[model samples]
Target: MSMFIRVKRKKTTYFLHCDPSETVLEIKQKLQALSENHVDDQRLILIANKLVLEDHKTLADQKVENDAIVAMTLKIRETGDWEEVVIDKPGEHPKPDTDAS
Candidate 1:
């Protein structure tokens, strides 16, 4: 029997089947296929417990169950420059800088 898990990325959520024996990397590949982002550029975090899933570990090893939600974030590697993923929520905007004369 296959288990289904929920994965959230920014404002989108995806439900995918979980293979108990598959490594985290394998799962990440499946996630990448479903997402526009690349597997190498993602950092998957379990939303329920805030655990970072390691590539070498299996889902069974991590004790992840059906309907688990994992949050996907862009993984930025150190390249001597800073790269950030900005999350823009609805109805929230950055305040403008106003200088009083």
Candidate 2:
């Protein structure tokens, strides 16, 4: 089965869906590769929307599964609280068709 990771960017959160078998590092690389704007490693910090994402830690270690929200913080929030977003939601997007490329 595959899993989904939620990466929180500046004022927004991004969703990355990948194989559950993949490691955290793999996911980080994938995020950078897929991002429209360049994403630096120094800016990448994993923070679960509900909990914490250990550094260099794989998703499997947390017993995470499909459609999970794996929050990734790019920059330190302004309120000094990285718990909640300062802006609005990134908005819902239609799922990419599996039949298409």
Candidate 3:
């Protein structure tokens, strides 16, 4: 079955459609096409468990499921260090009333 993941970086969220058999490297390549960041300079972390994803491992192997939230970090050119994950969540919306009195 096809699934999608929410790749969040800063305030931007990328919805990528993928299959469970797809490797992490493939996901990086897809992100590279969209974000223009080299695959080598990209790192993905599963936010739910703070697990760093391996490039050679398939999504199923890593237990990344449908609608999973992955944080993308880029390597700094000068420092050669990966940037900290920063996902800017949007402001919460007020809940609708449910009372029927």
lDDT of 2: 0.57
Write the number of the candidate with greater lDDT, choosing between 2 and 3: 3
The TM-score measured for candidate 1 stands at: 0.72
Question: How do the predictions measure up, each by TM-score?
Answer: 0.72, 0.52, 0.88
Would you list the rank order by lDDT, best first? 3, 1, 2
Estimate, for each residue in 1-101, the C-alpha lDDT of model 3 and write its tens digit: 99999999998899999999999999999999999999999999999999999999999999999999999999999999999999887764556889999
Cα deviation at 49, candidate 2, in Å, is 6.5
Candidate with the greatest lDDT versus the true structure? 3
Candidates 2 and 3: which is better by TM-score? 3
What lDDT score belongs to each candidate, Candidate 1 first? 0.77, 0.57, 0.96
Give RMSD (Å) of candidate 1 vs. truth.
5.6
lDDT per residue as tens, model 2, 1-101 = 66676666555666787776666667767777766433333233334445555546667776666656555554434554443433245554566779954
Q: Across residues 1-101, which tens digit of lDDT does each residue of candidate 1 receive? A: 57888777656777888787888898889888888677778777787787889999998899888888877777556663323423345657667779777
TM-score of 2: 0.52
